[model samples]
Target: MASPTPYRDENRRRLRSALVAAARDLTVAHGWPGVTMAAVAKLAGVSRQTVYNEFTDKAGLAEALARHEIEHFVDAVSTRLHEHGGDARAAAHAAVLHTLAEAARNPLIKAVLTSARGGADELLPYLTTRSELVLAAASAAIHDWAAARLTDPDPDRLALAAESVVRLTVSHIVQPSAPAERTATALAEVFTRLLG
Candidate 1:
Protein backbone atom coordinates (compact mmCIF):
# COMPACT_ATOMS: atom_id res chain seq x y z
CA MET A 1 0.00 0.00 0.00
CA ALA A 2 1.26 3.47 -0.87
CA SER A 3 0.93 6.46 1.42
CA PRO A 4 -1.25 9.30 0.09
CA THR A 5 0.72 12.23 -1.25
CA PRO A 6 0.02 15.56 0.46
CA TYR A 7 -0.15 17.32 -2.91
CA ARG A 8 -2.71 14.89 -4.24
CA ASP A 9 -4.74 15.13 -1.02
CA GLU A 10 -4.72 18.91 -1.27
CA ASN A 11 -5.95 18.77 -4.84
CA ARG A 12 -8.70 16.37 -3.82
CA ARG A 13 -9.77 18.71 -1.06
CA ARG A 14 -9.87 21.64 -3.45
CA LEU A 15 -11.89 19.68 -5.95
CA ARG A 16 -14.32 18.55 -3.27
CA SER A 17 -14.76 22.11 -2.07
CA ALA A 18 -15.38 23.25 -5.60
CA LEU A 19 -18.02 20.60 -6.07
CA VAL A 20 -19.76 21.49 -2.83
CA ALA A 21 -19.74 25.23 -3.56
CA ALA A 22 -20.99 24.65 -7.06
CA ALA A 23 -23.76 22.37 -5.88
CA ARG A 24 -24.88 24.87 -3.30
CA ASP A 25 -24.83 27.78 -5.73
CA LEU A 26 -26.73 25.87 -8.38
CA THR A 27 -29.25 24.57 -5.91
CA VAL A 28 -29.84 28.09 -4.69
CA ALA A 29 -30.07 29.66 -8.14
CA HIS A 30 -32.29 26.92 -9.41
CA GLY A 31 -34.52 24.92 -7.14
CA TRP A 32 -33.25 21.66 -5.67
CA PRO A 33 -35.32 19.79 -8.23
CA GLY A 34 -33.62 21.71 -11.00
CA VAL A 35 -30.04 21.27 -9.89
CA THR A 36 -28.28 18.58 -11.92
CA MET A 37 -24.83 17.01 -11.77
CA ALA A 38 -23.95 18.36 -15.15
CA ALA A 39 -24.73 21.90 -14.06
CA VAL A 40 -22.61 21.48 -10.96
CA ALA A 41 -19.73 20.15 -12.96
CA LYS A 42 -19.93 23.07 -15.33
CA LEU A 43 -20.19 25.59 -12.50
CA ALA A 44 -17.26 24.05 -10.66
CA GLY A 45 -15.15 24.03 -13.83
CA VAL A 46 -14.41 20.35 -13.19
CA SER A 47 -15.04 17.47 -15.48
CA ARG A 48 -18.19 15.44 -15.08
CA GLN A 49 -15.96 12.50 -14.22
CA THR A 50 -14.25 14.51 -11.49
CA VAL A 51 -17.59 15.43 -9.94
CA TYR A 52 -18.69 11.81 -10.08
CA ASN A 53 -15.37 10.66 -8.66
CA GLU A 54 -15.75 13.03 -5.71
CA PHE A 55 -19.46 12.45 -5.26
CA THR A 56 -21.09 9.31 -6.62
CA ASP A 57 -24.33 11.03 -7.52
CA LYS A 58 -26.58 14.00 -6.88
CA ALA A 59 -27.70 12.57 -3.55
CA GLY A 60 -24.12 12.05 -2.48
CA LEU A 61 -23.22 15.55 -3.52
CA ALA A 62 -26.18 16.97 -1.60
CA GLU A 63 -25.17 15.02 1.48
CA ALA A 64 -21.66 16.40 1.26
CA LEU A 65 -23.09 19.91 0.92
CA ALA A 66 -25.32 19.37 3.93
CA ARG A 67 -22.42 18.05 6.01
CA HIS A 68 -20.31 21.03 5.09
CA GLU A 69 -23.11 23.43 5.95
CA ILE A 70 -23.68 21.73 9.30
CA GLU A 71 -20.01 21.88 10.19
CA HIS A 72 -19.86 25.54 9.29
CA PHE A 73 -22.97 26.24 11.32
CA VAL A 74 -21.55 24.47 14.36
CA ASP A 75 -18.30 26.40 14.10
CA ALA A 76 -20.16 29.68 13.91
CA VAL A 77 -22.28 28.79 16.93
CA SER A 78 -19.18 27.79 18.87
CA THR A 79 -17.54 31.09 18.07
CA ARG A 80 -20.58 33.09 19.11
CA LEU A 81 -20.92 31.13 22.34
CA HIS A 82 -17.27 31.70 23.14
CA GLU A 83 -17.57 35.40 22.54
CA HIS A 84 -20.64 35.82 24.77
CA GLY A 85 -18.79 34.55 27.88
CA GLY A 86 -20.25 33.57 31.28
CA ASP A 87 -23.86 33.25 30.17
CA ALA A 88 -24.62 29.80 28.86
CA ARG A 89 -28.32 30.45 28.40
CA ALA A 90 -27.76 33.69 26.52
CA ALA A 91 -25.11 32.05 24.38
CA ALA A 92 -27.37 29.12 23.60
CA HIS A 93 -30.27 31.41 22.75
CA ALA A 94 -28.19 33.60 20.49
CA ALA A 95 -26.76 30.55 18.75
CA VAL A 96 -30.19 29.01 18.19
CA LEU A 97 -31.73 32.21 16.91
CA HIS A 98 -28.79 32.96 14.64
CA THR A 99 -28.88 29.46 13.20
CA LEU A 100 -32.62 29.53 12.71
CA ALA A 101 -32.48 32.91 11.01
CA GLU A 102 -29.78 31.68 8.69
CA ALA A 103 -31.74 28.58 7.83
CA ALA A 104 -34.84 30.64 7.17
CA ARG A 105 -32.99 32.84 4.69
CA ASN A 106 -30.74 30.24 3.06
CA PRO A 107 -31.81 29.73 -0.49
CA LEU A 108 -30.69 26.13 -0.60
CA ILE A 109 -32.69 25.27 2.51
CA LYS A 110 -35.68 27.15 1.20
CA ALA A 111 -35.47 25.37 -2.13
CA VAL A 112 -35.26 21.95 -0.52
CA LEU A 113 -38.11 22.63 1.86
CA THR A 114 -40.34 24.17 -0.76
CA SER A 115 -39.77 21.42 -3.29
CA ALA A 116 -40.37 18.57 -0.88
CA ARG A 117 -43.41 17.42 -2.81
CA GLY A 118 -43.51 15.42 -6.06
CA GLY A 119 -40.27 14.05 -7.54
CA ALA A 120 -38.26 16.15 -5.16
CA ASP A 121 -39.52 14.38 -2.03
CA GLU A 122 -36.02 13.02 -1.55
CA LEU A 123 -34.88 16.55 -0.75
CA LEU A 124 -36.92 16.64 2.45
CA PRO A 125 -35.66 13.27 3.67
CA TYR A 126 -32.10 14.21 2.86
CA LEU A 127 -32.39 17.55 4.64
CA THR A 128 -34.24 16.12 7.67
CA THR A 129 -31.74 13.29 8.17
CA ARG A 130 -28.85 15.67 7.66
CA SER A 131 -30.49 17.90 10.28
CA GLU A 132 -30.19 15.11 12.82
CA LEU A 133 -26.47 15.00 12.18
CA VAL A 134 -26.38 18.77 12.55
CA LEU A 135 -28.24 18.59 15.84
CA ALA A 136 -25.72 16.05 17.13
CA ALA A 137 -22.89 18.38 16.20
CA ALA A 138 -24.60 21.32 17.85
CA SER A 139 -25.25 19.21 20.92
CA ALA A 140 -21.55 18.48 21.21
CA ALA A 141 -20.77 22.19 20.98
CA ILE A 142 -23.37 22.99 23.62
CA HIS A 143 -21.98 20.29 25.89
CA ASP A 144 -18.52 21.77 25.62
CA TRP A 145 -19.85 25.25 26.33
CA ALA A 146 -21.83 24.02 29.30
CA ALA A 147 -18.83 22.17 30.74
CA ALA A 148 -16.68 25.25 30.42
CA ARG A 149 -19.26 27.65 31.86
CA LEU A 150 -21.55 25.73 34.16
CA THR A 151 -20.64 24.80 37.75
CA ASP A 152 -21.53 21.19 37.02
CA PRO A 153 -22.30 20.16 33.50
CA ASP A 154 -24.64 17.33 32.58
CA PRO A 155 -23.59 16.16 29.16
CA ASP A 156 -26.57 13.92 28.49
CA ARG A 157 -29.08 16.51 29.61
CA LEU A 158 -27.41 19.26 27.63
CA ALA A 159 -27.39 17.06 24.56
CA LEU A 160 -31.10 16.40 24.93
CA ALA A 161 -31.79 20.09 25.36
CA ALA A 162 -29.80 20.92 22.26
CA GLU A 163 -31.75 18.38 20.27
CA SER A 164 -35.05 19.79 21.47
CA VAL A 165 -34.00 23.33 20.64
CA VAL A 166 -32.96 22.33 17.13
CA ARG A 167 -36.20 20.43 16.53
CA LEU A 168 -38.32 23.32 17.72
CA THR A 169 -36.48 25.79 15.52
CA VAL A 170 -36.80 23.46 12.57
CA SER A 171 -40.52 23.26 13.13
CA HIS A 172 -40.72 27.02 12.98
CA ILE A 173 -38.71 27.04 9.80
CA VAL A 174 -41.01 24.46 8.21
CA GLN A 175 -44.04 26.56 8.98
CA PRO A 176 -43.84 30.09 10.35
CA SER A 177 -47.09 31.53 11.52
CA ALA A 178 -45.21 34.32 13.27
CA PRO A 179 -42.62 36.75 12.03
CA ALA A 180 -38.98 35.66 11.91
CA GLU A 181 -37.84 37.99 14.68
CA ARG A 182 -40.69 37.03 16.95
CA THR A 183 -40.23 33.34 16.31
CA ALA A 184 -36.52 33.59 16.95
CA THR A 185 -37.09 35.58 20.13
CA ALA A 186 -39.60 33.03 21.37
CA LEU A 187 -37.21 30.21 20.59
CA ALA A 188 -34.45 32.01 22.43
CA GLU A 189 -36.71 32.39 25.45
CA VAL A 190 -37.55 28.72 25.41
CA PHE A 191 -33.88 27.79 25.01
CA THR A 192 -32.89 30.04 27.89
CA ARG A 193 -35.55 28.50 30.09
CA LEU A 194 -34.50 25.00 29.17
CA LEU A 195 -30.83 25.65 29.73
CA GLY A 196 -31.57 27.29 33.06
Candidate 2:
Protein backbone atom coordinates (compact mmCIF):
# COMPACT_ATOMS: atom_id res chain seq x y z
CA MET A 1 0.00 0.00 0.00
CA ALA A 2 1.09 3.58 -0.67
CA SER A 3 1.97 5.88 2.16
CA PRO A 4 -0.59 8.37 3.38
CA THR A 5 -0.58 11.74 1.64
CA PRO A 6 -0.01 15.07 3.38
CA TYR A 7 -3.66 15.93 2.95
CA ARG A 8 -4.73 12.67 4.62
CA ASP A 9 -2.33 13.26 7.47
CA GLU A 10 -3.61 16.79 8.01
CA ASN A 11 -7.18 15.56 8.03
CA ARG A 12 -6.34 12.88 10.54
CA ARG A 13 -4.64 15.43 12.75
CA ARG A 14 -7.65 17.69 12.62
CA LEU A 15 -10.00 14.83 13.46
CA ARG A 16 -7.81 13.78 16.36
CA SER A 17 -7.63 17.32 17.67
CA ALA A 18 -11.41 17.61 17.45
CA LEU A 19 -11.87 14.40 19.38
CA VAL A 20 -9.42 15.55 22.03
CA ALA A 21 -11.13 18.91 22.34
CA ALA A 22 -14.47 17.18 22.75
CA ALA A 23 -13.07 14.97 25.46
CA ARG A 24 -11.58 17.98 27.20
CA ASP A 25 -14.91 19.78 27.17
CA LEU A 26 -16.73 16.77 28.54
CA THR A 27 -14.11 16.34 31.19
CA VAL A 28 -14.29 19.98 32.24
CA ALA A 29 -18.04 19.86 32.45
CA HIS A 30 -18.66 16.43 33.95
CA GLY A 31 -15.28 15.23 35.23
CA TRP A 32 -13.39 12.12 34.07
CA PRO A 33 -15.84 9.53 35.26
CA GLY A 34 -18.65 11.22 33.35
CA VAL A 35 -16.73 11.18 30.09
CA THR A 36 -17.54 8.25 27.82
CA MET A 37 -16.37 7.31 24.35
CA ALA A 38 -19.89 7.75 23.08
CA ALA A 39 -20.12 11.18 24.65
CA VAL A 40 -16.86 12.23 23.04
CA ALA A 41 -18.04 10.89 19.70
CA LYS A 42 -21.33 12.74 20.01
CA LEU A 43 -19.65 15.98 21.00
CA ALA A 44 -17.21 15.71 18.12
CA GLY A 45 -19.91 14.80 15.61
CA VAL A 46 -18.26 11.43 14.98
CA SER A 47 -19.25 7.83 15.52
CA ARG A 48 -18.26 5.69 18.50
CA GLN A 49 -16.21 3.44 16.27
CA THR A 50 -14.37 6.46 14.94
CA VAL A 51 -13.51 7.56 18.46
CA TYR A 52 -12.28 4.05 19.30
CA ASN A 53 -10.29 3.90 16.07
CA GLU A 54 -8.68 7.25 16.79
CA PHE A 55 -7.84 6.58 20.45
CA THR A 56 -7.81 2.74 20.69
CA ASP A 57 -9.16 2.91 24.26
CA LYS A 58 -10.09 5.21 27.13
CA ALA A 59 -6.56 5.12 28.52
CA GLY A 60 -5.18 6.16 25.15
CA LEU A 61 -7.64 9.03 24.98
CA ALA A 62 -6.71 10.15 28.49
CA GLU A 63 -3.04 10.14 27.57
CA ALA A 64 -3.72 12.20 24.47
CA LEU A 65 -5.71 14.75 26.46
CA ALA A 66 -3.00 15.04 29.11
CA ARG A 67 -0.24 15.45 26.53
CA HIS A 68 -2.15 18.14 24.68
CA GLU A 69 -2.78 20.11 27.86
CA ILE A 70 0.82 19.75 29.00
CA GLU A 71 2.09 21.02 25.67
CA HIS A 72 -0.24 23.98 25.88
CA PHE A 73 1.03 24.84 29.38
CA VAL A 74 4.65 24.50 28.30
CA ASP A 75 4.06 26.71 25.28
CA ALA A 76 2.55 29.39 27.44
CA VAL A 77 5.45 29.18 29.88
CA SER A 78 7.96 29.41 27.03
CA THR A 79 6.22 32.45 25.66
CA ARG A 80 6.40 34.12 29.06
CA LEU A 81 10.09 33.27 29.29
CA HIS A 82 10.77 34.78 25.89
CA GLU A 83 8.81 37.86 26.75
CA HIS A 84 11.14 38.62 29.66
CA GLY A 85 14.12 38.97 27.24
CA GLY A 86 17.00 37.32 29.13
CA ASP A 87 16.04 38.33 32.64
CA ALA A 88 15.95 34.84 34.10
CA ARG A 89 14.33 35.91 37.34
CA ALA A 90 11.69 37.92 35.54
CA ALA A 91 11.01 35.11 33.13
CA ALA A 92 10.65 32.61 35.92
CA HIS A 93 8.32 34.89 37.78
CA ALA A 94 6.12 35.58 34.80
CA ALA A 95 5.99 31.98 33.67
CA VAL A 96 5.24 30.58 37.10
CA LEU A 97 2.68 33.27 37.83
CA HIS A 98 0.94 32.70 34.54
CA THR A 99 0.91 28.95 35.01
CA LEU A 100 -0.42 29.12 38.57
CA ALA A 101 -3.10 31.64 37.67
CA GLU A 102 -4.12 29.71 34.59
CA ALA A 103 -4.26 26.43 36.44
CA ALA A 104 -6.42 27.95 39.12
CA ARG A 105 -8.89 29.18 36.53
CA ASN A 106 -8.81 26.23 34.17
CA PRO A 107 -11.76 23.88 34.67
CA LEU A 108 -10.00 20.95 33.01
CA ILE A 109 -6.99 21.38 35.28
CA LYS A 110 -9.21 21.62 38.32
CA ALA A 111 -10.89 18.39 37.27
CA VAL A 112 -7.56 16.65 36.93
CA LEU A 113 -6.24 17.95 40.26
CA THR A 114 -9.33 17.33 42.31
CA SER A 115 -11.32 14.22 43.10
CA ALA A 116 -14.26 13.51 40.85
CA ARG A 117 -17.38 13.07 42.97
CA GLY A 118 -15.38 12.48 46.14
CA GLY A 119 -13.67 9.48 44.60
CA ALA A 120 -10.36 8.92 42.90
CA ASP A 121 -10.05 10.63 39.54
CA GLU A 122 -8.76 8.33 36.83
CA LEU A 123 -7.22 11.28 34.99
CA LEU A 124 -5.31 12.51 38.05
CA PRO A 125 -2.58 9.93 37.50
CA TYR A 126 -1.85 11.39 34.09
CA LEU A 127 -0.83 14.65 35.77
CA THR A 128 0.69 13.13 38.90
CA THR A 129 2.13 9.58 38.97
CA ARG A 130 2.44 9.21 35.19
CA SER A 131 3.71 12.70 34.57
CA GLU A 132 6.92 12.04 32.68
CA LEU A 133 5.55 13.94 29.70
CA VAL A 134 4.82 16.96 31.87
CA LEU A 135 8.26 17.02 33.45
CA ALA A 136 10.17 16.38 30.22
CA ALA A 137 8.29 18.90 28.13
CA ALA A 138 8.39 21.66 30.73
CA SER A 139 12.04 21.05 31.58
CA ALA A 140 13.05 20.95 27.91
CA ALA A 141 11.35 24.26 27.26
CA ILE A 142 13.14 25.90 30.21
CA HIS A 143 16.48 24.36 29.25
CA ASP A 144 16.23 25.56 25.67
CA TRP A 145 15.19 29.02 26.80
CA ALA A 146 18.04 29.32 29.29
CA ALA A 147 20.60 28.02 26.79
CA ALA A 148 19.60 30.58 24.20
CA ARG A 149 18.97 33.59 26.43
CA LEU A 150 21.55 33.22 29.16
CA THR A 151 25.21 33.90 28.42
CA ASP A 152 27.96 31.29 29.01
CA PRO A 153 25.69 28.81 30.74
CA ASP A 154 27.02 25.53 32.09
CA PRO A 155 25.00 22.76 30.40
CA ASP A 156 24.87 20.51 33.43
CA ARG A 157 23.93 23.30 35.79
CA LEU A 158 21.41 24.63 33.31
CA ALA A 159 19.78 21.22 32.97
CA LEU A 160 19.59 20.80 36.71
CA ALA A 161 18.16 24.30 37.17
CA ALA A 162 15.53 23.75 34.51
CA GLU A 163 14.42 20.43 35.99
CA SER A 164 14.38 21.94 39.47
CA VAL A 165 12.20 24.83 38.44
CA VAL A 166 9.85 22.58 36.52
CA ARG A 167 9.44 20.26 39.49
CA LEU A 168 8.80 23.16 41.86
CA THR A 169 6.27 24.63 39.46
CA VAL A 170 4.51 21.27 39.14
CA SER A 171 4.34 20.89 42.89
CA HIS A 172 2.86 24.35 43.22
CA ILE A 173 0.33 23.55 40.56
CA VAL A 174 -0.62 20.40 42.42
CA GLN A 175 -0.93 22.03 45.83
CA PRO A 176 -0.74 25.77 46.00
CA SER A 177 -0.13 27.30 49.42
CA ALA A 178 0.05 31.05 49.06
CA PRO A 179 -1.22 33.36 46.31
CA ALA A 180 0.07 32.97 42.78
CA GLU A 181 2.13 36.14 42.91
CA ARG A 182 3.71 35.22 46.24
CA THR A 183 4.52 31.69 45.16
CA ALA A 184 5.85 32.99 41.87
CA THR A 185 8.10 35.49 43.59
CA ALA A 186 9.52 32.83 45.89
CA LEU A 187 10.07 30.44 43.00
CA ALA A 188 11.74 33.11 40.91
CA GLU A 189 14.18 33.79 43.72
CA VAL A 190 14.90 30.08 43.93
CA PHE A 191 15.42 29.88 40.18
CA THR A 192 17.79 32.83 40.21
CA ARG A 193 19.81 31.31 43.03
CA LEU A 194 19.88 28.01 41.19
CA LEU A 195 21.18 29.72 38.06
CA GLY A 196 24.01 31.39 39.98
Candidate 3:
Protein backbone atom coordinates (compact mmCIF):
# COMPACT_ATOMS: atom_id res chain seq x y z
CA MET A 1 0.00 0.00 0.00
CA ALA A 2 1.32 3.43 -0.86
CA SER A 3 1.51 6.12 1.79
CA PRO A 4 -0.81 9.13 1.38
CA THR A 5 0.93 12.12 -0.11
CA PRO A 6 0.39 15.23 2.04
CA TYR A 7 1.26 17.65 -0.77
CA ARG A 8 -1.34 16.24 -3.15
CA ASP A 9 -3.96 16.29 -0.38
CA GLU A 10 -3.11 19.90 0.41
CA ASN A 11 -3.39 20.91 -3.24
CA ARG A 12 -6.74 19.17 -3.57
CA ARG A 13 -8.02 20.89 -0.44
CA ARG A 14 -6.88 24.29 -1.70
CA LEU A 15 -8.46 23.75 -5.12
CA ARG A 16 -11.77 22.58 -3.64
CA SER A 17 -11.82 25.47 -1.18
CA ALA A 18 -11.11 27.94 -3.97
CA LEU A 19 -13.85 26.49 -6.12
CA VAL A 20 -16.39 26.61 -3.28
CA ALA A 21 -15.45 30.18 -2.36
CA ALA A 22 -15.71 31.27 -5.96
CA ALA A 23 -19.10 29.64 -6.44
CA ARG A 24 -20.48 31.22 -3.26
CA ASP A 25 -19.13 34.68 -4.09
CA LEU A 26 -20.42 34.52 -7.65
CA THR A 27 -23.82 33.29 -6.58
CA VAL A 28 -24.06 36.02 -3.95
CA ALA A 29 -22.84 38.84 -6.19
CA HIS A 30 -24.53 37.91 -9.46
CA GLY A 31 -27.33 35.58 -8.34
CA TRP A 32 -27.50 31.87 -9.07
CA PRO A 33 -28.36 32.26 -12.74
CA GLY A 34 -25.36 34.48 -13.33
CA VAL A 35 -22.94 31.98 -11.83
CA THR A 36 -21.30 30.05 -14.65
CA MET A 37 -18.36 27.70 -14.86
CA ALA A 38 -16.25 30.31 -16.57
CA ALA A 39 -17.16 32.99 -14.05
CA VAL A 40 -16.44 30.69 -11.11
CA ALA A 41 -13.08 29.74 -12.55
CA LYS A 42 -12.23 33.36 -13.22
CA LEU A 43 -13.19 34.36 -9.70
CA ALA A 44 -11.28 31.42 -8.26
CA GLY A 45 -8.17 32.52 -10.16
CA VAL A 46 -7.97 29.15 -11.85
CA SER A 47 -8.44 28.10 -15.46
CA ARG A 48 -11.75 26.76 -16.73
CA GLN A 49 -10.03 23.44 -17.21
CA THR A 50 -9.08 23.37 -13.56
CA VAL A 51 -12.64 24.11 -12.57
CA TYR A 52 -13.86 21.26 -14.74
CA ASN A 53 -11.20 19.02 -13.28
CA GLU A 54 -12.59 19.73 -9.81
CA PHE A 55 -16.32 19.85 -10.69
CA THR A 56 -18.15 18.30 -13.60
CA ASP A 57 -20.31 21.40 -14.21
CA LYS A 58 -22.15 24.22 -12.53
CA ALA A 59 -24.46 21.81 -10.69
CA GLY A 60 -21.51 19.90 -9.33
CA LEU A 61 -19.93 23.15 -8.23
CA ALA A 62 -23.16 24.10 -6.51
CA GLU A 63 -23.32 20.78 -4.68
CA ALA A 64 -19.75 21.20 -3.52
CA LEU A 65 -20.48 24.69 -2.34
CA ALA A 66 -23.58 23.51 -0.52
CA ARG A 67 -21.68 20.78 1.27
CA HIS A 68 -19.02 23.29 2.25
CA GLU A 69 -21.63 25.66 3.60
CA ILE A 70 -23.35 22.93 5.59
CA GLU A 71 -20.07 21.75 7.05
CA HIS A 72 -19.18 25.28 8.06
CA PHE A 73 -22.57 25.77 9.63
CA VAL A 74 -22.24 22.52 11.56
CA ASP A 75 -18.82 23.54 12.80
CA ALA A 76 -20.19 26.83 14.02
CA VAL A 77 -22.99 25.09 15.89
CA SER A 78 -20.54 22.64 17.39
CA THR A 79 -18.43 25.51 18.61
CA ARG A 80 -21.43 27.05 20.32
CA LEU A 81 -22.26 23.75 21.98
CA HIS A 82 -18.73 23.51 23.32
CA GLU A 83 -18.76 27.07 24.54
CA HIS A 84 -21.87 26.41 26.62
CA GLY A 85 -20.14 23.55 28.52
CA GLY A 86 -21.38 21.11 31.22
CA ASP A 87 -25.12 21.35 30.66
CA ALA A 88 -25.85 19.31 27.58
CA ARG A 89 -29.49 20.42 27.29
CA ALA A 90 -28.69 24.08 27.68
CA ALA A 91 -25.81 23.73 25.21
CA ALA A 92 -28.05 22.11 22.64
CA HIS A 93 -30.64 24.87 23.04
CA ALA A 94 -28.03 27.60 22.84
CA ALA A 95 -26.52 25.99 19.76
CA VAL A 96 -29.84 25.81 17.98
CA LEU A 97 -30.78 29.40 18.83
CA HIS A 98 -27.39 30.79 17.90
CA THR A 99 -27.35 28.86 14.63
CA LEU A 100 -30.83 30.01 13.60
CA ALA A 101 -30.01 33.59 14.52
CA GLU A 102 -26.89 33.48 12.39
CA ALA A 103 -28.76 31.85 9.53
CA ALA A 104 -31.40 34.57 9.69
CA ARG A 105 -28.67 37.11 9.10
CA ASN A 106 -26.75 35.12 6.52
CA PRO A 107 -26.70 36.70 3.04
CA LEU A 108 -26.12 33.39 1.28
CA ILE A 109 -29.21 31.76 2.75
CA LYS A 110 -31.24 34.85 1.87
CA ALA A 111 -30.03 34.64 -1.71
CA VAL A 112 -30.97 30.98 -1.88
CA LEU A 113 -34.43 31.65 -0.50
CA THR A 114 -34.95 34.48 -2.95
CA SER A 115 -33.68 32.50 -5.90
CA ALA A 116 -35.93 29.58 -5.06
CA ARG A 117 -38.96 31.83 -4.77
CA GLY A 118 -38.01 33.57 -8.02
CA GLY A 119 -38.30 30.23 -9.89
CA ALA A 120 -34.72 30.06 -11.06
CA ASP A 121 -34.16 26.40 -11.94
CA GLU A 122 -30.40 26.67 -11.53
CA LEU A 123 -30.78 27.82 -7.95
CA LEU A 124 -33.50 25.30 -7.14
CA PRO A 125 -31.15 22.34 -7.32
CA TYR A 126 -28.83 23.94 -4.82
CA LEU A 127 -31.69 24.93 -2.54
CA THR A 128 -33.48 21.57 -2.47
CA THR A 129 -30.58 19.15 -2.72
CA ARG A 130 -28.25 21.03 -0.40
CA SER A 131 -31.06 21.43 2.11
CA GLU A 132 -31.34 17.67 2.49
CA LEU A 133 -27.60 17.40 2.95
CA VAL A 134 -27.66 20.12 5.58
CA LEU A 135 -30.52 18.41 7.37
CA ALA A 136 -28.67 15.13 7.40
CA ALA A 137 -25.56 16.76 8.82
CA ALA A 138 -27.61 18.50 11.48
CA SER A 139 -29.31 15.25 12.42
CA ALA A 140 -25.98 13.46 12.70
CA ALA A 141 -24.61 16.16 15.00
CA ILE A 142 -27.68 16.01 17.21
CA HIS A 143 -27.55 12.23 17.32
CA ASP A 144 -23.97 12.32 18.52
CA TRP A 145 -24.84 14.83 21.16
CA ALA A 146 -27.80 12.80 22.29
CA ALA A 147 -25.84 9.57 22.52
CA ALA A 148 -23.28 11.25 24.70
CA ARG A 149 -25.83 12.75 27.05
CA LEU A 150 -28.71 10.30 27.11
CA THR A 151 -28.83 6.96 28.89
CA ASP A 152 -29.95 4.98 25.90
CA PRO A 153 -28.07 5.04 22.62
CA ASP A 154 -30.70 3.59 20.30
CA PRO A 155 -29.71 4.63 16.83
CA ASP A 156 -33.18 4.71 15.35
CA ARG A 157 -34.65 6.67 18.23
CA LEU A 158 -31.70 9.02 18.21
CA ALA A 159 -32.19 9.65 14.48
CA LEU A 160 -35.85 10.45 14.99
CA ALA A 161 -35.11 12.74 17.88
CA ALA A 162 -32.37 14.49 15.98
CA GLU A 163 -34.67 15.01 13.00
CA SER A 164 -37.30 16.48 15.29
CA VAL A 165 -34.84 18.93 16.79
CA VAL A 166 -33.67 20.00 13.34
CA ARG A 167 -37.22 20.34 12.09
CA LEU A 168 -38.19 22.53 15.00
CA THR A 169 -35.14 24.70 14.64
CA VAL A 170 -35.82 25.10 10.93
CA SER A 171 -39.38 26.10 11.71
CA HIS A 172 -38.15 28.83 14.03
CA ILE A 173 -35.85 30.09 11.32
CA VAL A 174 -38.66 30.17 8.79
CA GLN A 175 -41.07 31.99 11.05
CA PRO A 176 -39.53 33.66 14.03
CA SER A 177 -42.43 35.04 16.03
CA ALA A 178 -40.45 35.18 19.25
CA PRO A 179 -36.91 36.09 20.10
CA ALA A 180 -34.23 33.58 19.16
CA GLU A 181 -33.31 32.95 22.78
CA ARG A 182 -36.90 32.17 23.73
CA THR A 183 -37.31 29.91 20.72
CA ALA A 184 -34.14 28.05 21.62
CA THR A 185 -35.28 27.71 25.20
CA ALA A 186 -38.53 26.18 23.99
CA LEU A 187 -36.68 23.75 21.75
CA ALA A 188 -34.36 22.75 24.57
CA GLU A 189 -37.30 22.13 26.89
CA VAL A 190 -38.85 19.86 24.33
CA PHE A 191 -35.58 18.03 23.69
CA THR A 192 -35.02 17.52 27.40
CA ARG A 193 -38.50 16.13 27.82
CA LEU A 194 -37.93 13.73 24.94
CA LEU A 195 -34.79 12.45 26.57
CA GLY A 196 -36.51 12.06 29.89
- How far off is residue 39 in model 2, in Å? 0.8
lDDT of 2 by residue, 15-115 (tens): 99999999999988888888899999999999999999999999999999999999999999999999998899999999999999999999999887665
Per-candidate TM-scores read: 0.88, 0.95, 0.84
Worst 10 residues of 1 by lDDT: 121-130
Ranking by TM-score, best first?
2, 1, 3
RMSD of each: 2.1, 1.3, 2.7
Candidate 3 residue pairs in clash (backbone atoms < 3 Å): none
Cα error, residue 38 of model 1, in Å, equals: 1.8
Specify the poorest-scoring 10-residue window by lDDT in model 2: 112-121
lDDT of 3 by residue, 1-196 (tens): 9876999899899989988888888878867887888988888888999999888887788788778877888887777766655465787788888888887887777777677667775654543433678688887777666556556666665566567777788766655678888888888877666655
TM-score of decoy 3: 0.84
Off by over 4 Å in 3: 1-4, 85-88, 121-130, 153-156, 175-177
Evaluate residue 142 in candidate 3 and report its C-alpha lDDT on the 0 to 100 scale.
71
lDDT of each: 0.76, 0.88, 0.75
Say which prediction, candidate 1 or candidate 3, comes out ahead on lDDT: 1
- TM-score comparison, 2 vs 3, better candidate: 2
Candidate 3 lDDT score at position 81: 67
Off by over 4 Å in 1: 117-119
Candidate 1 vs candidate 3: which has greater TM-score? 1
